[model samples]
Target: MLLGRHPCWRQNPAFPAIKASTFRLRRLPSSNPSLRFAAGDREPRSFAAEEMGKPKQYWLLKTEPGEWSWDDQVASDGGVAEWDGVKNKQAQKNLKSMRLRDLCLFYHSGAKARRVVGVVEVARQWYEEGDGGHGGGGDGAVDVRVVGEMRRHVELAELKGDGALKGFALLRQPRLSVVPVAADVWERICELGGGYEGDGGDADDGDGEG
Candidate 1:
């Protein structure tokens, strides 16, 4: 579903307003001396303009395993599906904001717990569904493709228990379906996600997997 670029997005006016949450990172007491980011000089990776403004962007998607499983998304072509069934006004607005080619994280919510298990790409823009289509009161949705599963799951318990992520939105607003992850937060997650490992001489080998 593609929404023509909103005039407000260009002017950067705040239309859909939301409250802010605080997050902080702290080192965990671990014997694994190879985790170098623990010293705290690492910064999160920021999306370059070339990386942004594309038809797609990165997002975190949450769903209960009983309703939709990671395998369900993988079963679809390119893992694309019209993301619908949203009732929350804020969540709907976030869906409307997504662009094509955006990347998304597969988060399993509910009793199984919140964990980023995989990655997905936006294949379509905001489009209206139901009989009314784009012009009427129909709800909004987007097509997403599952790109790859996270090599390891970043569990909510692990995140909340981590000192560094003390201020993470996942900790503050557990109910928010769509939230922004700061550059720092992104890096920290990637690190915890196991993006960095195997530096040859590095001790401990970093064999943890999700």
Candidate 2:
């Protein structure tokens, strides 16, 4: 959740110890033509849904409540914000893999009441930050739009206690800011969050926070 320096980055050997200035700049295609990948230093990773033979994927994005709360994201322009300042290499890779319209759970970590507070959609794909140069420092930035808030927040305690969520990445890799969510897990979490109302002529139920 801490933008500038992540404590996990220091402890995780998987992350490379490279300076921000060393990253090279390259332009990559984006759903939004105006937005392009800021740094082309790394090998190109395809985020096309067809290439992966998958439908819309789900993700979980963790942020400290104090630094960037659900309300803060909802208040941003068009209920969207540039999810930037990610320093961890794995997290950066996750950002690169995101495709437009991908739904994400907005989890509030490091809060007195840590929980999944809301949902967001990827509005734009990867792009550079600020001046969009090699020295700009923001190598990973994804535009996310707030889809809706959770009708009832799902606590981490509940997730850990649920047997169905035993293999969830959040529990295995607590420090990872961005994590992929399995389709079934996504549906289960949505139900737990009071967002999913089962099919049974209950679609009119005010379950979704939006």
Candidate 3:
């Protein structure tokens, strides 16, 4: 991940200041590079259990409009629905690991423009929904419910343009479909989502992120 130019600030004359808290997930030495799961495997651990008996981790889930829309989730018989059809090994891993109460950032992809539209909560644990693509079965899946929508759509361009999101994994690993959201990143995004008061333009009251 490279730090590109910020339109708001000019290049400094001296050495640039680097944020000391930036995190990077190091790849473990392995013979294989692929992160997908093999046939007949179970889902990952529950993310909800990882936090204070509450879902603290944040995540982003991408779905095409033609397939499933945010409105579909909201209009469902109940707010909760199963999240399936995840074939990618890594994405499966993320879904399996998600806790029932985890927060998800709903994104619309494969369209004219990509944007994060709403927030959803994980409602069920990872379980094998049905027969996977292979003759085998037990693919990982999750259940989610639409919690709320962003006041303004957070476009990919805006996400790429934000200086505050320089270290976000969503920007760093765009193709990772499902990714972890650090606590700091989660709070920052909540702040970005209009401070969770339905007000999109209010500045933080000097309370810092979260």
User: Model 2, range 130-159, lDDT digits (tens) per residue?
Assistant: 644211346669889888888789999999
TM-score of 2: 0.67
Q: Which stretches of candidate 3 lie over 4 Å from their true place?
A: 1-55, 131-138, 195-210
lDDT score, candidate 3, position 93: 90
Residue lDDT tens for model 1, 48-154: 64356453345667778777778887786666666666666877777788766666777889985678877777778788767432112337677787777776789
Better of 1 and 2 by TM-score: 2
- Tens-digit lDDT track for model 3 on 1-210? 424345322366464655545546687666564754575246565544346556367899987766677788778768777778787788889888887677888888775758888888888878776765211343657788777888767778877787878878888887877878888776667666564323334455477774
Candidate 1, residue 81: the lDDT equals 62
If ranked by TM-score, best first, what sequence of candidates would result? 2, 3, 1
Per-residue lDDT, model 3, residue 11, is 68
Which candidate number has the best TM-score? 2
Q: Give the TM-score of each candidate.
A: 0.60, 0.67, 0.63
Q: Residue 90, candidate 1: how far off, in angstroms?
A: 1.2
* Candidate 1 weakest lDDT stretch, 10 residues: 15-24
Model-by-model lDDT, in order?
0.66, 0.81, 0.72
At residue 125, give the lDDT of candidate 1. Answer: 74
Instruction: Give per-residue lDDT, candidate 1, residue 155.
Output: 90
